[model samples]
Target: MSIQKIISTKSNLVTELLQNIAIEEDWAKIEQFTIALIDNFKDPRILPGLVEKINTLPFDEANAFLVYACGEYSLEDCKVFFDLWIELVAMGDFHTASNAGFILANLPEPFDFNERQLDQAENKLMLALSKPVTEEKALVIKEVLELLK
Candidate 1:
C-alpha cells in the first residue's frame, strides 16, 4: 500500500505497516515511510513509537532508512540508532554501514566517544574498507573516515 493511504488512514497500524514492509523488503514503501516520518518527527505522538519500531527492525535496507530518519533526531535521541549502526557495520551490511557512517559524520551535535570506542569504530571502518564494496559504499566510508579524523 502507498504511504499516503497509510497516512490518510491515520490508524494505529502505521507501525504494523512499517514492520510488514520491512519484512517484505519493500524498499520503495520504506523510503516513502522514512520521508513521511522524517517530515513529521516534530509531532510528539509519532516520533517515539516510530523510533521504537525502527529500532526493532533487523539491519537491512529498512534499517538503513531508519538510520537516515533517525538522523533528524538529537544526538541523545539517536543513541539507539548509533548502537544499531555500529552493530550493522561490524556485521558487514555495507549499505546500512555506509549510510550509518554518513549519518554519524554529519550529526549536528558532537557525540563524545571514549578512546576505546573511537578505536573500535576506526577499526571496523578500516576493516570494512579492506573488503570489496561498491564505490558508493567506499565513498561513504571515506567520508566517515574524514569525519573521524
Candidate 2:
C-alpha cells in the first residue's frame, strides 16, 4: 500500500511501532524506495523508533531506511543516535559496522560532539582502524575521524 493509504487506514503497520522498538518487519514496511523522492519527508512520528532500535535491526534494511531518515532529520534529532553511531563504528565485523560508520559520517551537519563523545569516538575509530577494511570504507571512517577534530 502507498504510505498515505497505509497511514490513513491506521494499518498498525508503520505508525504503531514507528516510535518504539519495531520488529524487523515493521521497519521493512516503510516506503524506503520512494522516501527520498518525496523530499522534505520528515515524518516526526519516526523519532523514537529510529533511535531505540536502529542498531538492533537488520543492518542492510535499517541502513537503507535510515538514509532517508538522516536526509530529513534535524541535527537535534540526529543527536539522539550520536553515541550509537560511535559504538557501531567499533564493531569487529565490517558487514555490521560499515553502514553505521557511513550513517555516522552522513548524519546532519556539524554532528557536534561533547568532550566525552569525542573521546569515545576517537577510541572507537581507533579500534575500527585496527580491523581489515577496503580502502573505500577506510576513507569513510577517516573522514569521520577528521570531523571529530
- Best-matching candidate per lDDT: 1
Model 1, span 21-129: residue lDDT tens: 4464466876776566556434443445555655567766656666656666444565545545555554435677666776676655667667887677778878878
Question: Which segments of model 1 are wrong by more than 4 Å?
Answer: 1-34, 41-59, 73-76, 89-95
Give the TM-score (vs. native) of candidate 1. 0.59
Tens digits of per-residue lDDT for model 2 on 10-112? 5353454453334545544544422432243445555555655555554443454554454355545666677776665564245435555666666666555
RMSD of each: 6.4, 5.8
Q: Quote the positional error of residue 26 for candidate 1 in Å.
A: 4.8
Model 2 residue 83 CA deviation (Å) reads 0.8
The most accurate candidate by TM-score is 2
Model 1 poorest ten-residue lDDT run: 40-49
